[model samples]
Target: MDVSIIETSSLGDRSYLISAGAVGVVVDPQRDIDRVLALARDRGVRITHVLETHIHNDYVTGGLELARTVGAEYVVPAGDDVGYQRRAVGDGDLIDASPILLQVMHTPGHTHHHVSYVLRESNGGIRGVFTGGSMLFGTTGRTDLLGKEHTEELTHAQYHSVRRLAVELPADTKVYPTHGFGSFCAATPASGDSSTVGEQRTTNPALTQDEQSYVDELIAGLSEYPAYYAHMGVINTRGPAPVDLSLPAPVDPDELRRRIEDGEWVVDLRERTAFAAGHLGGTLGFELSDSFVTYLGWLYQWGAPLTLIGENEDQVADARRELVRIGIDDLAGAAVGEIHTLVAGTELRSYRVADFAALSEALREKDTTVLDVRQRNEYAESHIDGAINIPLHELADHLGTLPDGEIWVHCASGYRASIAASMIDRPGRTTVLINDDYDNANDTDITSAT
Candidate 1:
């Protein structure tokens, strides 16, 4: 049996296609089922089962639709209160999928009913375990996602869940997790790219630290996740509609301007530098990239009529796929063409993009107002001295309170800063994007840590 990893880097998550002979089983698929279908087709394998580790709290799961498309059995843990029909599995249940056999292990940490599937050969030789959200690369899934009231209890459960996997599974069993590549689902940033049960024994915090210590540290390290996560569980539980990857109907410049004037979301999918150079006044610059979906979903007003302003049709199409992964379907329309043409006689808004070196030099000549758009915890760890900490997500509500002058915006990387700079740019304010890494700030004498 071979395990094929299907990575969705935007959400920092992975889905797996475990195949033996002509049969395959998919675990934790994203909303875009075409990717999984294409993979199965390429491998010449028929999908026999689609298993969801839990009702996901990040992206909408494609498991239900994928199963329906291929006539595969949809398997979910027994205790989740879901709306759809499926094969409800519980702990100690053995699944026979041809040459591949799976044993269910009740791992109640990430969620109350989360389960990990132990993959084995027909002869009972353990190959690996899919520990979704429970045991990640180095840390575990954050316990506060369900709510703060359950954090402590879930943290305790998370500690034991990791311990249970370590003690019960063979030392060499491969570890496959659904979250923690870069997802906020992780309690902390996961380390490295891959690990095994044996490797985790030496490096995983839950394995090395005492249970109480593990729980305490995990809870203490928890930080803010995206606001969009609140809607993911609800959408996943109710069963998400089949995704619409078709391009949104073309929107004319007149209508695009009308939508922007009427206060609808008109997201611009272009490179950060290009967006900084020129963009529509009210359009958000979410540059089509890996981080685009996470930040866009975090700040997006749920259920709002969203329109796309892309440089080309392909860019808008790509953005649509990313948006659908998080359940942002039903795009109002999309306007694609040169920014100048799409402006419809309205002048394009522009901003200056610079690096930390420019910031350091500017500080020498004048008292510059710097805005750090990173998370509060990140700001506490280290930031430029006197830089205002209005995280990008909070910038919209607090934009009016920002001190006047040329506001220099920055984040750990230029991504959030570019977004913030676009939001803060207006009639009289001078917005400069610090398009550089925050570590570069340390090269000067402007950085400080608490």
Candidate 2:
């Protein structure tokens, strides 16, 4: 049997293509089906089945369309009322695809109806387990995405679900999880990508603790998830549009300006230094990185038209892929050109980037308001003495609460701070970005608060 792990770095989600002989099966596929299809063609295998562990709340799934396109069986969990045609599967159900036999295990924690598929040979020898969000590398999936009301209950379920896997599966069985590796869906940060059932039983924190203790720990560790996540489950249930790889229409400078004037967002996908040097006035600087889709989806208004500005066509294409994952597909057009040339006569905006040492000195000269854009839990743990807490996701809504003066913005690292600076930076109001490593703040002479 052969299994290919396709990692979506932008969202930190993994999909698998498992095959034996000329038949293959896809598990937890993303919206982009081209890559999966190409892999099948390259391997000279026909995709016989598409399986979804649960209704994903992080990104749209292309499983339905992929299955339809390939003339394969679309298997989904029976717990969800996904108004669509599919082979609804439940616990103890067995699926046969030649040499690969999948046994469904109902694991409810990430969702009420989540299931993990245990792969075995025709002779019943355990090979691997596709433990979607139930079991991760060093932790389990966060149970709070559903809502606060379901948090405790789901966490309790997660404890039992993980325990069941450890007891039922062999120690050497490989565990493949969908959420981990920088995904916020994880209960805690994962140490690595893959882990065996034996490793998890010995090292996983959730596995070691009792049900109540595990529930408390999991609930307390969850930070603010993306706002766009709210719509994903519903969208996945209804099914999403087929992946459209065509590039968005190209817009010249005049059209870009016109859209900006019409209250449409002009997102500049460039590095922080390049964005900080000189960018179009009122153009939001969102660096094209793993966190691009996260912040953009959080800040951007739903259904609003957006014009993308990138250094080149490739950068814009990358940004489009990330945007589509979060259901932000209302792309008006894209502007691909040099920043200076595009905004010729207009005055470009820039902010001063400083270190913690500079921030300490600046605070001495005048009373400066420092804005800490980390999550609430992070802020609660420790922060600069006088800094105000306004998580980056909620910064736009709390702009009015900011006191007048030189505002010092920062996050764990420089990434989020750079984004915050671009949002709150103005013509007259000076905003200094403390772009240094957050750990360095602890060494500074400046007092800190918990």
lDDT (Cα, tens digit) per residue for candidate 2, span 1-450 = 998998998888999999899999999998888889999988889999999999999988989889999999999999798868999999999888887789999999999999999999878799999999998988999999999999889999999999999999999999999888778788888878688999999888778888788888788778888888998999999988777766789998887777766767888899987888887877888899988998888778888788899999999988888888877776889999898778746777787888998888887888888999998888877788888889898888998778776889899888899888888877777878777898888888775666
The models' CA-based lDDT, in order, is: 0.92, 0.87
Cα-based TM-score, every candidate: 0.99, 0.97
Worst 10 residues of 1 by lDDT: 215-224
Candidate 1 whole-model C-alpha lDDT, 0 to 1: 0.92
